[model samples]
Target: MMISAATPFTLLGQNLLLLPQKAIFWEQQKALIIADVHFGKVGHFRKAGIAVPRDMEQSDLATLSDLISEYRPEKLLFLGDLFHSDMNNDWDWFILWRSQFPSLQIILIRGNHDIIADSHYQKLNIELYDELLIGPFLMLHHPLPDIQLQHASGYVFCGHIHPGVSLSGRGRQSITLPCFAFSSKQAVLPSFGKFTGKVAIRSRLTDKIFAVLKDKVIAID
Candidate 1:
């Protein structure tokens, strides 16, 4: 499957490709940065007697595969929430997927929903970290506090709230779309999972917001 053309944006002098798949490819680092995948979410709900389409899980994996094929990144950096819940049948699916890419370096910054045992991730060769500082960006699951941002060493790339933007039309119609929210000191990525909620964000006058549409990423004017 082919993804829509990725939109390029510069932050802290680093060139990043914002894909319609709700992920970022850092050009210099050759890393695919994504967040809030919630891999086992569908299964978690289904197990609880909530009827969710089982194909939804496979679709997410397919999109990831497409991104990997398209970019061939050296590493995949998951800001947080790689899995929705603890070990479940959905985990088996993830295991099968991981086996297909044994050479890919996957890293996850532990998120609130990431309650799975460390040993499980270790067995899959996935690196775990609370926060990672690489080059000019600090990779984290949750955005830093206002006071911490004041003294932060580099621009932070985080994804906890599943940030989005509300767009208005001429007839006072408005819709919220997942977005890449960029301020001077931080950037929030959209959730990379199909079954996730997005919180519409209030942007500043100087902030740059790129809304992800069905097949493209568009800059919000």
Candidate 2:
């Protein structure tokens, strides 16, 4: 499988590629940054007798494999919510996926929904952190509050809330799309999981907002 072309932009002096797959690739660091994957979400729903398709987990894994093959990133960073719930059968799929890229460094910044045991992640060789500072960005799961942003030393890359933007069309019709919300202090990535919901965000006039369409990412102007 081939990945669609990613939109390239410069943020905080770093080159970033916003892929149509709802992920960001940091060219300088060779890192692929994604958020809110909620890996076990389907299983979580099915466990409750919701009757989701069994292949949903496999699809997500295949997408990840395609992205890894396309970008060849040395590191894969999950901003947060790497897993949807507690241990489930879906975790086995993730473990198998990880095995394919044993040399790829995987990092997870703890998020609100990440409740799995540390031992489980450790066994898979995934490094866990509450928050991480690398280069010019501070990677985190939740966005920093206004007060905290004022005192921060570097730009922040975060997820959670599954940020999106509303685009008004002709007449009264309008559509909402997942987006990359970039303010001066921080940037919120779109949710990488197909099953997640998106929350339209409020952005300043000067903020850069890129909406993810079916096969591409476009600026909101």
Candidate 3:
């Protein structure tokens, strides 16, 4: 296992640590970056009379808690899709989780799946934004095209598509793994929620791709 659970990469003169947990850490900002968490997804499925594991949300929350304890980030920046859909019993878990980290500022960039009323987030002391320009990065729910991104005021960090890259072996085996894709103008983060699906991405020669493994992240050469 890759015990460190971190891979360092520098962007726009600032340092970023890509983590196996499908999150990122902005060293200068002292913030934990997560995208597409879909917190209540399992509950949504179960609500439809489908059998889904009840521990999924708890597991994801536990992982987030662990990261918080280890990094001690002052703020939590969520790119988008923080919750799956609607207000469900699973929301109570989030409320309890929020209570534990009363001092840690949580910020969410509004996304399509975030249909919950603003009052709900406000009640938890969470800040909501359509888009945000923080330091050298512009945070958004949907990633912009390269043309638009080039003219953006800052390097972009966004997530909407759950990105993945296909890997092939000498034995004709192929597998798709979630990845962190970095282009000259933007960085598309992988979905942090394990219950989400991944879409394979075709990257350019100059782009950097970091494939996430079970316990570590590896850069694709």
Q: What is the C-alpha RMSD of each candidate to the true structure, in Å?
A: 0.9, 0.9, 1.5
Q: Give the TM-score of candidate 1.
A: 0.98
lDDT ranking, high to low: 3, 1, 2
lDDT of 3 by residue, 1-221 (tens): 12457999998889999999999999999999999999999998999999989998999998899999889899999999999878999999999999999999999999999999999999999999999999989999899997797689888899999999999999999999999999988899999998999999999998999999998999998
Runs in model 2 with CA error above 4 Å? Answer: none
For residues 29-72, could you state the per-residue lDDT of candidate 2 as single tens digits?
99999999999999999989998889977887899899999999
lDDT at residue 121 of model 2 (Cα atoms): 94
Give Cα-based local distance difference scores for all models: 0.93, 0.92, 0.94
TM-score of each: 0.98, 0.98, 0.97
Model 2 gets an lDDT of 0.92
Tens-place lDDT per residue, model 1, 1-221, is 69559898987788999999999999999999999999999988998899999999899999999999989999999999999978789899999999989999999999999999999999999999999999999999999877899998788999999998998899999999999999889999999999999999889998899999988899988
